[model samples]
Target: MLDIYEFSAVFPSGTEIYSQNVQHTIRSNRRTLGGSLFFDKLLAQLHVKSVSESRPPSANRGYLYPPSKDGNLEELHDKIVSAEIADHYKQSLLYYLLKDCTALDDEEAAETFAKKSHLSHKYWIVIQGLWNLDHLQFEAALEYLTHPSLLPAFPEDILRVLIDHGKLANKHLPLAYYNAVRPPLTNPDLQKSYVTYLAHLSLIQAYFFIETQPVQDHKSLFELLIDDALQHSRSDGSSNVVDELINLPLTAEQEAWFEEYLLEGKGRTYHAARDTVVARRLALGKYAEAIEAGQQLSGRRFNDINWDGIKDMVATSLGSRVEVDSVFNVAEI
Candidate 1:
């Protein structure tokens, strides 16, 4: 057994090398095992050390039993002592000790090893949480991974897994997990995936969540959120989500971002995206700008209904539906 000092020298903390090694080792465990491969592998390593090393025959064996003199003993020896398995064993010893202690039915030896290893318990919890994910136990994974005590780590990787592989009944596991953990993702790809998921799940929630993000990221996430909403909306203007998005009480900065995204950014592909922006302007009581935008739009959802008629219709709808103090006073229009 390697001492804690030797282990620390081999795997320095807070390095990319250590993080990748832990991730690789956890992902290597076979998902088919009902119980932990950690315990079984540890037992095999102890058995190999007992037989191969020059230990005295009278040494305390603890829970290990002497193998019967049979062909099975040789086969087990050959399998556990292989170079590939031994290297993996070295990488996984710390991870295994952590898992064993956190298991529902704990092992005292594993706890003892964990104490001796002197690894951070938070790091151990994170690895165990990810191990649960590798096995497709999402609920159990979330319970530990999303706990308030744990600071976010490996956030983008975890988000990718949940978004790509979660098979919950509602298909909202990614959104749920993100809401609970709120990991600050720096990768553009993962940020796009996460916000796209959130937009499709709940436009209002996505809007509010975007409000809390960094101002630099707000425009991109908002643009993606609006593009996703527009893409999924029916051309005939039937999506309640579209209505919710258009009617959102946006801040002045958000309103400018929304207009720029639809009028000049990636939201231009959809036929009704511009018209949706005009409707939003109308909802925000920018009647003059709404009419100007309507005239500039090359494609309109209602080509036959003139801008004046559309304005009257929108004003009527807002008068009946919107609260006087919440949005704008209809009388002002």
Candidate 2:
């Protein structure tokens, strides 16, 4: 039977010396189970004592098990004696241990430990944090994303990180994330916001790719836009045709057709067609043209179209909305 009193007495200096001695003993007698148990128990006691000294006075004030209570100390002592500190302090300690355990570099070891730790909720947090954008450990990210405990948090940050790092093109990343997290992402508002953000990013990417990339045929670009719109429509319950039209990329021919076939027609309805034309113009880096076209369209619908803003954004690359005007003239007119 381990004496808890004796263990508590060796705090300030005995702890370090005990650790060194334990390490030496473990090396010398690798096969001694009794020795291993004794060393682990002593080390656990030392750890509990250290934590006790450093803990804030306010901590555990309202908890059922207050740190300084005799009963809590006895519980710690019992855990140490049983060589089961791993079970008792697993969640709190594992979080610290896994902080630098790289998902890519230390994946196997980390995953093995995660399985053995028997603390799935805390383990999920560790895995998700490691897979975030700052880490960009794709292999690790995918591995953790597959974990049953880490589904929703996995897609949200990981996809955004990939997009920000340019590892995934704008069109694919959002859809991928949306798909990955959909089963778990139950909030309609969050779903709508994420889809809208993705749509915006896809439109920005399409504009840049079309203007600078010397596209031989418009098929891929059109497909990307249509797909993005479709995804948004699916996620948000919006009409697919409206979304497609609003996201279309207009060429000179399409612009001319809009003027003759749509805008000049007797029953001209400017809102939907104009929104699509403006969106296309914005996507083409044709700011002045966008502004002019936007102004010709009727209703307060074009009011939301920022023509001066778009004009200032002409020379900039896609997604760079640096332009600001006193007000959107199209909206006023």
Candidate 3:
């Protein structure tokens, strides 16, 4: 059990020696001295951080015997879907089993088993949504998530799976983005979930991967107009989309928006939002705004991009607004 692992963590340098010591102490004639209790408390203090692992039903999976690993997983799955046998803890067992199925890429069996609990079994419904999402069954996942009964218990998991699905997907980014990330931010029914911040992150991801229109003044400008574009500008990982966006002249609306966003950073938090607003300010030739935003960041965020070099560049461009007309070569910064 976890208590045993606690022992190993504390005595990692001499695990065998620690085990033998505990054993000898237990067997010694010192039982009157409370040696076992002392050793137990000593090891108990060394609790290792644990992530709970769901174990499968080893026997009696259903009306029939459980099959071997892959095939048995499918067989238990079949019984889990059977209405007559699905009444008790069978559904719960199926939820745990499906994780293994997903790990094994047993998509056909997992998907087919998942559909049986669509309208009922909120637990299985979430499990199925995760399984379907893993298999890239976006439509099924959206449909699976629509049950209303399934949202409250694990909204964060559902939200993350949807966002991840959209991230890896190519063709359905727009629909997947809307289906997965948008509702958690807007839906009154889900107003209590604390994942609104993650939804903001996902919203910008949608813009990068899918949302677009015919090139306007610049393709980067059009991309920047996607609402959440500024939310995660650092996400593009060397694409320079953020820099390209900064290089454009800020519209009255954009400047106002950047001002508003930077103001929301109470201090040293909302790092991504602060960085994007600073990048925009640097390009808009607003050295004051750049200096204020840069100063508000935590050391971690300030170091995210070289703020010293950037400060010098912005200071250099103060009166000139040089980057608006040229490439804004602040990559060194």
Candidate 4:
């Protein structure tokens, strides 16, 4: 099995990949990798089933079955060899399946088999990365996982693992990995997690990232991005998250969505959120609605309101709207 020391020795800049305090952090979070979904995915890809009533009971069968610790390397090896799996996949499968084996020879056999099958070095990197991830060795995992030679397999899972297991200091590592790999984030859960992380980094960054996403996802994620800003603003008055959000120069559709989100959606929960709705309406020349929303804000955080910021937004909004309307009017003419 590839250890952190081996990884650091192999890579030229491995020693500098993480901070000096990371060893203490990793020790505090140490646990078995068997608990991760990555481990289950490895088993799932091999089509390893669990004990069931329909299947007859046998020692070999029980050993091959998941969530059952009653098997050994010999039985697992025999089962893998007999199965109809493709040859290329079999080597990696053997490596992982034999990883937890206590016997020293079994672990060596896995490495030897991988070599015999001529598994690509990148594949070995993936294995080591995932192995480190499993053991909560985050820094080492990042070093291996972010290697240029490997394809982005289980990208969403990799992110989830990093976010789920990593400490606060290691927060930037996930973003680093995301920037390096640029994984396609289609899963909503992964999207939320990544967005939350982005929000933690910067509200402006989050807004820009959300802007780049598919249109259909804009509403929920935009809503989430606002919610994050609101919460951060509420907690830390000097955070500037809200300040950044209001002055974002949102498109017409986004402006409408923002107004609706603040007025009717999760934004309603935060203090002074309606003030933004009022400022936006005033910016876009909706006097009646602006007055209406503004009236509701009276006696609530009156002195705390950012009238200057609102005025600035209105000035920028009027100019932008006039330009857009002028272009449309010319087309109509």
User: Which candidate ranks first by lDDT, i.e. highest?
Assistant: 4
The lDDT, on a scale of 0 to 1, for candidate 4 is: 0.61
For model 1, which pairs clash?
Answer: none
Candidates by lDDT, descending order: 4, 1, 2, 3
Best by TM-score: 4
Per-model CA lDDT versus the true structure: 0.58, 0.42, 0.41, 0.61
Clashes in candidate 3: how many?
1
Candidate 4, 101-169: lDDT as tens digits: 312233454466456557667777777777667656788888988899888878877877776656354
lDDT of 2 by residue, 1-333 (tens): 212234343111221221334234333332222222222233444454313333432322322121234444344444344454554244433322233233214434334445544545644553454423233344445444545455354344344444444234334544454455553333433333443455555555444443432244333434344445544544565654444455455677545654444345421443355556665666666666665566544434332444444445553543434332322343443
- When 1 and 3 are scored with lDDT, the better candidate is 1
Off by over 4 Å in 3: 1-66, 69-131, 134-136, 146-153, 162-166, 171-240, 244-282, 286-333
What TM-score would every model get versus the actual structure? 0.56, 0.31, 0.30, 0.67
Poorest stretch of ten by lDDT in candidate 4: 3-12
User: Model 3 residue 319 lDDT?
Assistant: 48
Off by over 4 Å in 2: 1-96, 99-134, 147-171, 183-193, 200-333
Model 4 misplaced regions, further than 4 Å: 1-35, 49-71, 97-117, 167-169, 236-238, 278-292, 302-333
Per residue, candidate 1 scores C-alpha lDDT tens digits across 54-173 of 233332221112222223233333434343544434334445433532442443434555455554676556656766765567767777788778987566666777776663424777
Ranked by lDDT, the better of candidates 1 and 4 is 4
The sequence of per-residue lDDT tens digits that candidate 3 reaches over residues 1-333 is 111112222112321221333224333412322222222221123221111123432221221121223333334334344424333234444443444334445444334444543424676665555445544556676666666665543344444444444444443543444455444333322221212332344444423432232223223333234233344444644334445445545457645655564465332244455666776676666777666566554434332556545655665766444542232333332
> What number of backbone clashes does candidate 4 have, counting pairs of residues 3 or more apart or in separate chains?
0
Clashes of each: 0, 1, 1, 0
